[model samples]
Target: MPTIPSLSGLRGRNTRQPAVGRIPVPMSAYVVDCAVYVDGKRLPRRFTHADAIAEVRERGEGFVWIGLFEPDDEQIQGIAETFGLHELAVEDAVCAHQRPKLERYDETLFMVLKTVRYIEHESPTTANEIVETGEIMAFLGRDFVVTVRHGQHSGLHGLRGELEADPERLCSGPAAVLHAIADRIVDSYLAVTDAIEEDIDEIESMVFAPNSPIGAEHIYLMKREVLELRRSVTPLANPLRRLAEGYSPLVPDQVRSYFRDVDDHLTTVSERVGSFDELLTTLVDATLAKITLQQSTDMRKITSWAAIVAVPTMVVGVYGMNFDFMPELHWRFGYPLVMAMILVACLILYRTFRRNRWL
Candidate 1:
């Protein structure tokens, strides 16, 4: 085994710390190899190709975890060939835009998972900002475990750190690594749900106070954001549902408990996303209803005022007629009488409107 090199700083640290004894280091920006456990002791560098393959061929035990970061197609193909994985799985691994999914090929299992980290400060939902979506396509066959991802994912990093801290679980076998990965992905879903719940609270407030200037852009943005999140995360249900049903051979009997828990978490997440869609729909309806009510109120007020003024104008029009035979036209009190009549009519109409609560 090679001497573990010292790392200046590890990510996800609130405070800095000095290097310790033997530390497993990342091979490149694209790959990390770790020797899980050997001979009842956790080695600094766990296993290689020969060691990993020999264990399955010989002792029928042990596990190897190879984390791939932003790997090219050639490297992916090479990994597939090395591990005896299917060509279709390798093709899917190289593809960037696949939704969360899973497949079984011979003795191997290919699982594509999505892990999201919410940018709460930047936007309302995971869709509004660039989330750290982890494309964790793992090959869990025999004694080897390979996880390929597109970029640096905090959930993956955290899982690896946790397994390193407790070598017993990771060293237990390949199943342990699969368990850790599943657990971490589920945790990420919970985190995203928290952020979405906060957005729901904001939407609730807006629903009650519909007059408070929530622009069209905001509604459009909210609708689009939730839809994007729904699209990205929903496909995962297929894979998880399959796993929960014990469809994958790579998933052990003991690990099924964890997978079941993950299934529950996924169900919760799906419910939340559905609720968010309903909330947005309600908001749109409420906004439109408020606008319509305001318009109707304004029109009623205009009609009421027009009726009040029409009474006085008609009285004046009759008195101003040029007919010589008109009695009120020649009378000394005619103008005053006509003016009083007009005043009485307006007063009566105004009082009637007020009584009817139409003023």
Candidate 2:
């Protein structure tokens, strides 16, 4: 097995802290594999931007994968200029927070893919919910691959590791690299889907149980999450579909089938997202129904109490009228009798309510 740098140990000097004032990072590269099996001593040297173009021109046949993470805008422009990348594609890659998708620009193919990591944070509650956001952009050419992105993208890291581990895969060219990237990206979505579904299951249980612990705000936030997920992944389907159907010279004949497999994976993700959206809608409805029912139950109790108290209120009102001919007012047991009558009326109302199943 070919040895590649371990992701867990690849300590970037600048990664621990943000770069100052949007300065462009200088480019870097290292060789994972050098020579082809058939081409004996003919090995392509790994090089950075200006050198990469020169090296490609010299060799004129082998493939290359140049990945950039949180690169400076000027450096990105320089790479594009060196490789003759489309201006629009370069601009899109430089722009942050773009949805995942693939676009063809004449000879080159531009693909924007989401890279997600499940971040765990301390919480008062037992476990923390995942915090997710990352992106990877690839500009695929006939003989070279350029990937640019913001933040620490694990998907890209995995692809690099895979390439390093298996030299044969590196020789598989642009299409294989694209497939590796897509597979990792799809795996990210699967992770998110699993978390979301788990949340859904919790919400479902809460729906049936009276006085659920999960709050209304949490469910609404979850709905918003699913909506955002749909927004990010939906645009990606068409590009993957095109690649799967073998639309370009970049995607190899052997690997087009795998791209189709990736397309199916995204299709499954899309369908699940749709179903989750509906489940979220149902959760909202169920939450509202539970709240309404509880409120109605409370209101009935208050109204019933008020109705039973009305008799005592009426009796006091009549006694306070101070009419000399009133029979109860002149009796010795008048005050006690009035208290007794009020108590009796309360009991009678309580029994009536119990009989009617209104309590």
Which candidate has the top score in TM-score?
2
lDDT of each: 0.71, 0.73
Listed in order, each prediction's TM-score against the native is 0.71, 0.84
Q: Write candidate 1's Cα lDDT for 213-302 as tens digits.
A: 654456667777677777757888778777767886677777677777878887887888888888788778877787787788888778
- State each candidate's clash count: 2, 0
Runs with alpha carbons beyond 4 Å of true place in candidate 2 = 1-25, 28-46, 121-131, 153-155
Runs with alpha carbons beyond 4 Å of true place in candidate 1: 1-27, 33-36, 39-42, 46-60, 122-134, 151-155, 215-220, 302-359
Clashing pairs in 2: none
Q: Whole-model lDDT, candidate 1?
A: 0.71
* Model 1 worst lDDT run, 10 consecutive residues: 123-132
Top lDDT prediction, candidate number: 2
Give the alpha carbon lDDT tens digit for every residue of 99-131 in model 2.
877788888999888766555433212343443
In model 2, which range of ten residues has the least summed lDDT? 31-40
